[model samples]
Target: MFLVALIFIIISYGMVDSLRADYAEKWQLDFQDPATPVMEGIINLHHDLWFFLILIAVFVLWILLRTLWFFDRSRGTVPSKVVHGTVLEIVWTIAPSFILLAIAIPSFALLYSMEESTDPAITLKAIGHQWYWSYEYSDYTTDSESLAFDSYMLPESELKEGQLRLLEVDNRIFLPTHTHLRVLITSSDVLHSWAVPSLGVKVDACPGRLNQASIFLKREGIFYGQCSEICGVNHGFMPIVIEAVPLKEYVSWVSSQIQI
Candidate 1:
């Protein structure tokens, strides 16, 4: 079993650099490709923590095997002798403390970065209903000039060609790439969560209260997410789609909506 695992690890290590996924797959075990700075940092921190986790697992397994082999009745004719070394105790305690410290530094940094909003170029408000999402642009001075829309999931039979069943929505949120965005989320009736895996955002929308988060998209693409929190019978029907475009295209889209 150990030899088989060792061979598997060796093969996987060689293929690590070549294994890249740009989007989510049907049976994906890894994270969807990150499209924002915060998501990139999340991926990096995940890898860093996994390195320590694997190291600790391997060390613990080796110790278990060694103890079994040496302390077994078949190998030892005499009773086991008690041994306690202060250096070993101290080393174990201090080593774990340093490892936790190393892990904490990056964890705290990512949390702070996720919450940081600096001179937002755009502000988007997402209101969650029992089964749909409504968005509003807060930049417009008047209600008539502002853009607002409700995104409803398309029925499986209504989905067009190439559209993902249960994932397609009539209206997708559009944002400009390489721009700072402040998103405020709130629930109208029940609790809901707005999440996008590629963008690494998941904020709960509680009733009568607003939760804010910041996003800085680094690339242009179509990203999909679902309402993570269960609100009602149609909770699974609410899906979130974000279309990231160039600044010029984004402005053109807003203008067209305003004119309508």
Candidate 2:
């Protein structure tokens, strides 16, 4: 019974670790859990590239080892008069070309998919300031007043139990799952970046220029990100949190916000 309980505990801990990827973890070696299709594709492409990289690395290592073994100084082998082999050179060149072609095809395909424009059901505008983010729901307005709010990181004193220290925010961007959403990012002052790894979005927020990206949430969770670009002294304090909820819950939240 004791052994069974220990095994169960280990398995449970591993499962929890794998599922908790919305926020940054200590000593994290992999990407955060994917909450959108774009992130899923990004992870898949990364794995595919790793496969090719491993193959190339192994082949190079084998060639190096073979050469070292065959050309050892102790063996005193006679040197061949041939300077180079055309067949060998051609094989190395043509092999890389084919490998490059294989890599390029999928890379281009993923890039196109990422840049493809789509009609969005909801559009949100994010404006970055010195140390905080301002969001506006451009799609919904009442009496010329649109739903907008500023998100600031919660200080350590204000954080509750189980809340992340630098990652928690007073207000989080709430959106509906399985909905096509467009986010327009720009800066009110210096350059900033609106990045959320789970959603696979990293758009530069530049002054006088607006950048747009598409997001389609596939799950419900709180995803966290930080300003990737160095904007000011408090850039590290500016964090982003997004909460994906069901359609009905999102609508209710929206209604409540508009009322406020």
lDDT of 1 by residue, 1-260 (tens): 99999778757645432222134677889988899999999999999999999999999999999878877897755744759889989999999999999999999999999888788999999999989999999796455455788999999889754566677789988899999999999999989999999999999999999999899999888888899997889999998988888999999998888877
Clashing pairs in 1: none
RMSD of each: 8.6, 3.6
lDDT of each: 0.87, 0.90
Write down the worst ten-residue block by lDDT for model 1: 14-23
Q: List the residue pairs that clash in candidate 2.
A: none
Model 1 misplaced stretches (Cα beyond 4 Å): 1-23, 77-79, 141-145
The most accurate candidate by lDDT is 2
Error of 2 at 144 (Å): 0.9
Per-residue lDDT tens digits for candidate 2, residues 1-260, read 99999778767655442244388788999998899888898999899989999999999999999888988989997668999999999999999999899889988988888888789999999999999999999888999988999999999999755678898789999999999999999999999999999999999999999899999999888899999999989999999999888999999999999988
lDDT score, residue 256, model 2? 96
* Count of clashes in candidate 1: 0
